[model samples]
Target: MKREMKEQLRQVFDTPDTRRKEEFLQNFNYPKATYREFLFRQIGYIRKRVWGLSLVLILSAFAVCKIMKDNDATYSMVWVISSLFPLLALLASTEIARSSSFRMSELEMTTRFNLGEVLLMRMGILGLTNAFVFGIVLFSVAFKINYGCLQLGLYLSVPYLISCLGSLILMNKISSREVVYCCAGVSCFVSVFNGILANSKPMIYSDKFVFFWIVLFILLCIAIVNQGSKLIKKTEALQWN
Candidate 1:
């Protein structure tokens, strides 16, 4: 009975003949994930702490903005909001630099998605997420304060951009886990500097120096792009090596 049962099972589940196998292989349609699909999938894989901390920052800023509105502390609102921008950069830079942070570049390179591609996707996703958060925070504060979109945008963006610029430069220079901590320190320093400027040179945010902020913003944007390109090239080099 056992022998008969084995024979029956073997007959039902027999390996395909060579001719059939060849035909099947020829006609096979391997499903490929589109860029959008892959991107959305990667979003889910991001650490929950990133999203949580971002939410915490947003809520904290809104709460402060509310209190500042009640107290009529307009400049204080900008100072509080702008200071938090570095923390956003820290979240993003840490995630992007995580590959090198833990010496996972070699293992990541061996995966289906190469290390550079993975890093690029992560950077793009985290960047867009952070930008959206920034926009919401910036506009919310702008609506309540006496500041225009351009003025508030520059006030908020310059510090965040500066942090990003510093982070990318540090990432390019250092490849160890310590780079993550250094990026954190850079962000903290930027935040502290914002406090100093708000306290000492509030005139910098005045209309007369708006042009100065604009020029600084443009320069930082250029520097960030240049550094980001270098970092990507370095990651690609690591993949080949």
Candidate 2:
């Protein structure tokens, strides 16, 4: 079996066709990984490791929602979700920054696995899990209060995106605790702004507000994605303190 593998490898190296040689080299350089396979591998690891955090966040969100006795709760849900879920998700994001915090960055850099992909996988799991939790709370709230599906989704999305942007911005600049504090402050401020926006002179009820916010969301999304990619690179090159 070893001899056969060696002979095949030799044939590939000795191939006269440049296209075949290049194809062989490309195959050797990059392993095949489909989106589905990655979800099961990297995402699966995150699910098992992070289940405790996810459970706490969901329970807390549900408990908070349950405490609101009033049907017309005066923007309570908005403030809670905007302030809490995004902050929790942002805190979860710092898990990937542990390599820098614990001074394991050098070892992490030496690993054969793709650090960027690992970073992204962790972020995606945290983000999606909180999003689902928040969505359930919002959907339950909508049963008691007045909020359209569009409004619920967009309002929840804005602060989450902002949280992600802030996390990506600070992932390399400070320790994980600092990231949580800074992001919590930001989320609180945005939550207050959301409450004010919803209660006083609400623009969501106005025509084209959805369209405008959608455009704004898309623009912010582009920024988040760009910054997030750069943050991954920064994570890989993080300096030990």
User: Best lDDT goes to which candidate?
Assistant: 1
Full-model lDDT, candidate 1: 0.90
TM-score, candidate 2, is 0.66
Residue pairs with clashing backbones, model 1: none
| Per-residue alpha-carbon lDDT of candidate 1 for residues 1-241, written as tens digits (9 for 90 to 100) | 9999999999999997566778897688865667787788779878999999999999999999989999999898898889999999999999998888878788878765677788889989998999899888988888898889998999999999999999999999999999999999999999999999888988988999999999999999999989988888887777842
TM-score of each: 0.85, 0.66
10 residues in a row with least lDDT, candidate 2: 232-241
- lDDT per residue as tens, model 2, 30-110: 456676777677566553546676667667766666676445453666566655556555556656566556665577555
Candidate 1 lowest-lDDT run of ten: 232-241
- Report lDDT per candidate: 0.90, 0.66
